[model samples]
Target: MSIQVGDRLPEVVLKRIHEGIESVDTRALFDGRKAVLFAVPGAFTPTCSEKHLPGFVEHFQQFRDKGIEVACMAVNDPFVMQAWAKSQHVPEGMMMLSDGNGDFTRALGLELDASAYGMGLRSKRFALYAEDGVVKQLHVEAPGEYKVSSAEYLLESL
Candidate 1:
């Protein structure tokens, strides 16, 4: 089953893009704080590029103001995720985590087989609100749907 509210996030090493690629632990990110962790099926897709990412980019400050650390995770490599961040002009404060091998994705039970769509194993579109390593809210979208996972809705849910 997919992760649910009140479930502790699995300890997984997510790749992060910086000057060099860094492996970050999931627990280190969420421990002792509130955070918004949202995932997309792939980077640079139409909806994800035009809407999903920008929504978070636009509201990042507000999320920060509320003391919530926001990060975007995808099933791409660090290079691609970093390139997408640069293309979108994403702020430095927001993290672009790469689940390069889909380890974290599978651990969360949110992996989607998108070979038909040209992408292989990937994360389903979802948004998670976690506090101190435990989830407080989880929103998984229906296939090809974007309603519940947008940043605006996350703000409302928060």
Candidate 2:
């Protein structure tokens, strides 16, 4: 089943290119703070690059001002995520997470099979708000739609 409000985020390790491809544990990352984790189907895709990530990068301060840490996740490897972040000028503290194996995406039941489009297993466009590891809000976009999970929408909903 897909994760819902009130569900605790599953235990999973996601990667990021910090010093050198650091591993981040979900529980440790969200256990003591409020955080917004937004997932993209793939990094550098049209919609993802043109709109999705830019919105988050633009409004990253607002979320932080409200005491929430923001993270962007994708099924791509940490190297791709790092390149995308640099190209987009993503803020320093905003995390770029890589679910390379799709393990975390499957664990959340949010995996998307985009094989027909030449992309293999991936994550749906979705965002969730969690406090101390418990989900408080989840915005999962319909297939091929981008509305609820947008940074503006998530900000207003908060």
- For this target, which candidate reaches the highest lDDT against the unseen true structure? 2
- Give the winner by TM-score: 2
Whole-model lDDT per candidate: 0.94, 0.97
Model 2 gets an lDDT of 0.97
TM-score of every prediction relative to native: 0.98, 0.99
Tens digit of per-residue lDDT, candidate 1, span 110-152: 9999999789999999999999999999999999999999999
Per-residue accuracy of model 2 over 1-158 as CA lDDT, tens digit each? 99989999999999999999899999988999999999999999999999999999999999999999999999999999999999999999999999999999999999999999999999999999999999999999999999999999999999
Off by over 4 Å in 1: none
TM-score, cand. 2 vs. native: 0.99
Candidate 2 residue-wise lDDT at 151: 98
